[model samples]
Target: MTDARHIEAQIYERLNKVIDPELGRSITDLGMIAAINAVGATSQGDGDVPSYDVTVHVELTVEGCPLSQTITNQINGAIVSYPDAKLTPHIEVSSMSHDKLADLVAGLKAERKQNPFNKPGVKTRIFAIASGKGGVGKSSVSANLAATFAALGYDTAAIDADIYGFSLPKLFGVHTQPTNLNGMLMPVTAWGVKLISIGMFAGADRAILWRGPRLQRSLEQFLSDVWWGDPDVLLLDLAPGTGDMAISVAQALPNAELVVVTTPQPSASDVAVRSGLVALQVPMKVRGVVENMSWYEHKGERLEIFGAGGGRRVSDQLTETLGYDVPLLAQLPLDPDLREVGESGRPAVLNEDGALRSDVLGRTFRELAEGLLRSE
Candidate 1:
């Protein structure tokens, strides 16, 4: 019986590493492990290696939780890692009772409160991607940058702040709705990044994305209602235009810095400066400018598809106007794969296996991400 008790203790220790994907807390700590029963040696035990049959009872936050399989697989992996003992594992998972779930949520809210990022001492780096107009690839830039951060092992979360033109759900390939426990909602995890978008909720593209009757209120909902456990970075894909969303974000997230996206053209660069100029009206910072579709390589020669100096022009203007050095952070080439692969729900800078690519686009994005994290 001492041996059984010892095995159970070890199992509990290992389970501390198994985090609930949505809640971002260990299942064991959430009081999910109701019991652990370990019996004597099983036939599968290697000769004298003291093998035992262990059953772990798991209580999930909700019934038919979409990520139950992922949680189960991780628990199984944790159990089988006990090489000292030949442990045959069985995990019995069931939904927590209504009262228990309510208590757990209440406790979590009381501890962390709502809108966790705005609190003092929070280290989350928030970036709001903006543009003067549509078709400049702001959402694409937001999706790729967020993916690059996640692939590099930074805990990352993104909100599709573009209420009318939400595309992050498609770009990140997220098809699952956030699991709602009582009133609190969990952001969906896809491509190693935590994402929240109305596109994933109502099931239709344009119709569902329009739920944000008030853009500012919707931003608040995404901030307060979702359970984001203090990620290292938070990115907002702002709508393409100089409008209320930027001010709303500045008011809600005082630390949010703006990263303006512009194409290589006088028309785009001219208005791009206005988007960055929103900082003049609000207390947010204008981080830098990203020039998209700067050039296209055609038959061994570089072709200036949209014209060459728009990114620099916006950067120079913003720097002079904002009285801070708003440098041109990156110059992205026009790659067809950025659209095709993105339409397939994967960021172009990442490989099929979800690893950061070693190609030019990937390297450039990595540099951009590193630049953003660097000190001024």
Candidate 2:
């Protein structure tokens, strides 16, 4: 006969494997496994097996978590692994109180501070996508690149670090604010990518005319206040131009690699080169260049709408100026359908054969994601 205590221990061990999908921590460690009561059969009936009724109380961060079903299933599956247990586990799901959740968030923040990735020990591949000017598709590229990486099964997030010009929420079609659980802010998920942006907090068209100090404070809060769960890749959509916000981003993520975006025109490249130089002020590496609107495909011929070689020119200048090889990561052509998809609040990568179909640019984004992962 199996000892009841032994079975209980085994059950606890199994529960450790059941992690909170969002938090990336086991329910046992997170204090989400509120209670585990095992009621054993007092006596065995003739030709009948004994049974144990186990009740597991789970505390969810949000009142209406989309992952509640998944958590329940995981808990039930884990409880049944004990031999001769005759498993009948009753799972109770409840939300943590605001105060208690606040404490949890505090603890998580402390843990992140101590985490190697957050520290200088572990390397987190941070990419800042900056352009010389707005409407150059920097935000769109950041959003799509993040989605592509997440689709490839990497833990990824795109921070709308452009505090004043936040647009990630619209691009990813996420309208909800991050839920606070035990003080930790759970990032909104869409297209398998976790996202945090000021757009979620402020209205899309609402103007935020904050000063430099307030902007810096907001940026710090975005990084420290939110629970990012130690992502494998973090893509930052930096506001265009070299300003205080860009400087703050560089300071916040010291190891961030830069990918300057520009059109094919020489003037665009010239302006983009200045932004790349600003990245150098923080001494961040200029990874490569992404040239948007390089050309438009008319029939089978590629028409150079924005002129050409701007991406190459920027890459060449960065390599020469920085004393390192800065290659052109990709040249994204002008796809009207891609712009339409963005306007419709859906990423082109997820739609099959859509405007942003699986073409060279798409492949390049995937490759860029893979390369970053490998570098990390």
Query: Candidate 2 at residue 67, lDDT?
Result: 86
Clashes of 1: 0
Determine the C-alpha RMSD for candidate 2 after optimal superposition of all C-alphas: 3.1
lDDT of each: 0.90, 0.80
| Predicted candidate 2 versus true structure: per-residue lDDT over 6-98, tens digit per residue | 666777778999999888899888778777777776566666666888877888877899889999998888877666658688998898877
Model 1: lDDT equals: 0.90
Best candidate, lDDT: 1
Per-residue error for 226 in candidate 2, Å, reads 1.0
Clashing residue pairs in candidate 1, if any? none
RMSD (Å) per prediction? 2.4, 3.1
| Candidate 2 clashes between residue pairs 3 or more apart in a chain or in different chains | 101-182, 101-183, 105-182, 105-183, 105-184
Worst 10 residues of 2 by lDDT: 114-123
Model 1 Cα lDDT, one tens digit per residue, 1-376: 2388899989999999999988889999998898888887644433557788899999999999988999999989988889778788999999999999999999998888778889999999999999999999999999999999999999999999888788999998887888898999999998999999977777545453333338789899999988999899999999887777887899999889899999999999998989999999888999999999998888878899788899999999999998989999999989888999999999998999999999879999999999998845
TM-score of each: 0.94, 0.89
Off by over 4 Å in 2: 3-6, 40-52, 80-85, 97-103, 114-118, 202-205, 352-358, 374-376
